[model samples]
Target chain A: MSVDLRSAFFYSRKDIFKNIKIFIIITLSIILATANIIVINGLIDGMIEDLVDNTVESSVGHLNIYPDNNERFIEGIGIKEQRLATLKEVEAYSPRISATGVLSNKELSVSSTILALDPDKERKTTKLLEKLVRGAAVNPNDKNAILVSSRLAEDLKLDVGDEATLAFENGIIKVYNVKGIIRTGNLDFDSSTVIMPMDEAYRQLAIDNMASIILVKLSDKSMSEIYKPMIMQNLDVNNIRTWEEETEFVSNFANSWRSISSIISGVGLIAAAISVGIVIYINIIHKKRQIGIMKAIGTSNAFIFTVFLMEAAIFGVIGVFIGDSVGYLAIKYFEANPFLDAISQTWISARFEPQLFYIATIFSFGVTILAGVYPAIKASRVEIIKAIWGT
Target chain B: MEIIKTSNLKKSYMLGNVEVKALNGVDTSIEQGEFVAIMGPSGCGKSTFLNLTGMLDTPTSGEIYLEGKDVTNMNSNMRAEYRLKYMGFVFQFFNLFNELTVMENVMFPMMLNKRSNYKERAKELLNLVGLGDRLNHLPSELSGGQQQRVTIARSLANDPKILLADEPTGNLDTASSIEIIELFRKLNQEQGQTIVMVTHSPEIGGMTDRIIHFRDGTIEH
Candidate 1:
């Protein structure tokens, strides 16, 4: 039958508003589901951003190289002999000497991961310079100057220019001047680290002409596969790791968060579907007689279905707009509020992203429309005689 | 020429293993431009007969011919098309879409037919029904008589050949019932519109050109 599009629109709109409570409930359910989806997705994105920022800023460059024997943790009187490559092959590279040590002052002592790096090369290889909370980057030529984390400095009561004694294995001990303090907002790294020049580390540990590992930065991430094997072959090092491989813990954590968020969003979607279905079903029941009257007046079933679907589409649009606004405002509030500091300290920082908001809104609207199908069909299937006679 | 003709029409209901016959081998014909009323007591199958003729219900057995075309076994879609092109209906309750204004209610059928100038046509119909001044009023805002008048205007939206009214005045007061009957009479006399109304009120039934009394699923006269 030729259905009147305008009449269907008018009739559906009237029915929707006439039963205001159902309309409101359907819209509210859609909004809540959409908000949950947006917030969960936002949280996961924030966590990934934080993990990548922390990993890239601290020590792991885009790539890393270690001696073939470095994996066995061999204890020797001196550093292991290994062939090193020319610096010209890499965009940038930094030598690092990593070992466990104890930091001590007049009043306090703490165990920390002591990383000795060539500061000038480190600056070019990573975002280390941007993460400093106080003082300057370590001087490549200063033998006694060292940089410690803010938490370590706080624990040891050491300030810039203060002398701190570091004790290593085999009765090795060195006293160093605190040059700077750094806070990366990552508790795992910020609470237990110390940085010094590689030469200073070699002298203190009684090693000569040796470095534990080399960190390299490529011009682009896509070039990692090409450079990784070349770097290993040139340096004669079989033990190597990329940033993604070395940071399995953080990557796994982010993956788990993603999966959990998807599950939550899935549940929210199902709830939205059920809510819309129930609302449309009840609406059809309430309007059966009206539908019958329309049909008896020569309206087609297709027209009836279109009318209900249009009502659902309208609800979806309104709900998506409302949910997106609320979700964005909530994210913005979290970004501006100091109460989120606890999360930032442990996880990642939050930021506003308009793209995510739009994506969530469109997704919510699509879901609402899909959920409207069965109810519309049921409404259109109403028999005219039974409906009009209340049978 | 006959606008509606039915032969050996039968309809039955299964009420928990009890077969109740609503229409039993009923043969009837309605001529074009003729005003007729079907009168019967409660449960005498007056409504069932009207529904069958209106194409709203299917007869269990037999054939229905509209303008010499067999439509007994046609699909629901075809039935709807036939109804839209050839028939109009008014219910006992004045079944106006309560949310719509008087003009909108009148324009509904015209919209279904994809008729152009729907606004102008709706306004003209409302004026003809003496509701031009109340065109913007909702169905709930109007009196029962006024609501029925709107229903009458709605029935004429497509200018259908026949108007099948099922108890059109069943719920109205005496004065309102008389008004509706007079309107139907005018449509038949002036517009040459055929009308078949099912009513229990003998007073209203007396106004039609012919009366077919029904008893136990069969027409008596």
Candidate 2:
């Protein structure tokens, strides 16, 4: 028959049902590859998002301002209130003085970070007040009271209301009662944090209101690029850093992870493409006689080629579509019930990326089209007489 | 008037550097509405000459005139176009698309053309070929004779100017062969359909208007 493209398309689709084995194999291959890509990419993105959130909430705020040149600590809000509030990006700011000190009882001593900050302002910037595992939040009224992480307290074997002496730099020493125990999701930070009233820390360090750092919290961290320059332009400070800058480890991990995902997904799909290619090759070769008959009957080469190519494309689309639907269900399931980090006490959910679907669809269709080229051409160029004679 | 005429028709093969002439410098003609049979031994170039005449293969050297038009030099695509528009073919093996039903197979030739009467015409042809009831049956589901009937039905789908059959009953038993040859004789006598066939059977050849016997690629009578 003189087959038109429309007839060939419908014929090829119906023929796919006739050859169910090859159809099933090609469909399953695309499904497996597509599902693997979506799930793996979701997991990776989920981990990165969790890391960024935890870092921002635990240690760094949206931005950080250290002292100017030739100095380590900045003495209070060197940038005036009118100047700070005028930027419009500053949602809230926490001023704190940090020092490395040793806390000891009669039996043990461990080095840790001591932060002296206003309890009210710190609560607005971080989750310290909300994440208290035992005892109350830090008290600004008690000059001799301090807060410690549950990990740090465990390390020193200290509890709330227990008296421990803290030794600071420049030979200053003081004894204080532990008032609260807090647990942050980060293991490293949890094991080394000690908090006290800002006035008491200045007295112990004898630094005269020279706060070590001021963390500037923004309404949106993503707008740091626009706000950072404005903040820098407003203040005479040179050492300000954003949360993304402070958490370089997370960014590096995310970048490395993306490359790995690409390699793994790329390899799987290419293998599938080659497999589908081989099947198409076999199909065309086996049907050489039929193709020859068609050619002799005046069926155009282009029409025959379009038939096979359309068949391959339909395989890719149908398979990827089914796989994507199943994968989306998986993504939503994971999103609703996140994996638990028992040690950090955190819940992390995967990020569902729609681009994964777009990329997978395009790649799958591309693979089949590319693979079908040689076989389609071979089918189109069948030697009519030899093939019809079965030679 | 001659519907097909060949002048100095030649076809050869280089089998391992040895030249084997399948058809060597033979000239022949068949008038329109004539039923002709070609008889030859194996390897006497009967099938080669049929292929050259049908444009199924290019001749090694010769000029072939179809309705007084020189078609020997036409390209493969043009030859295919000409053949599709004006000729029908029946093969020994039935060569029906095994996957298609009898009806679909019958409609295949006309399907190449955008004809609206394909279904009704195919049904009419199948009924005429005594396979009207087996329209939905695949070739594998039918007897060899029934399958040959389907190919014959398919051969008339395009309503072409000429019908070419190459050992149309080579795979059939005596009874089926007689029936098929009788159908060809009926077609030639009733409809004035020009028919050219190749066969080894003298009984079948005797039913035709003329039988051209070939020996060493030339007509003996």
Q: Judged by DockQ, which candidate is best? A: 1
Deviation in Å, model 2, residue A36 alpha carbon: 3.2
Model 2 regions more than 4 Å off: A1-3, A78-87, A103-110, A128-136, A142-165, A173-187, A341-345
Candidate 2 lDDT at A253 equals 83
TM-score for predicted model 1 compared with the true structure: 0.88
Per-candidate count of clashing residue pairs (backbone under 3 Å): 0, 2
What TM-score would candidate 2 get against the native?
A: 0.91
- Specify the poorest-scoring 10-residue window by lDDT in model 1 chain B: B77-86
Per-residue error (Å), model 2, residue B48: 1.4
- For the record, the alpha-carbon RMSD of candidate 1 to the native fold, in angstroms, is 3.8
Clashing residue pairs in candidate 2 (N, C-alpha, C atoms within 3 angstroms): A1-B112, A2-B112
DockQ of each: 0.71, 0.48
Model 1's DockQ?
0.71
What lDDT tens digits, residue by residue, belong to model 2 across residues A63-97? 88888878887754745434676777788777888
Q: Which docking class does model 1 fall in? A: medium
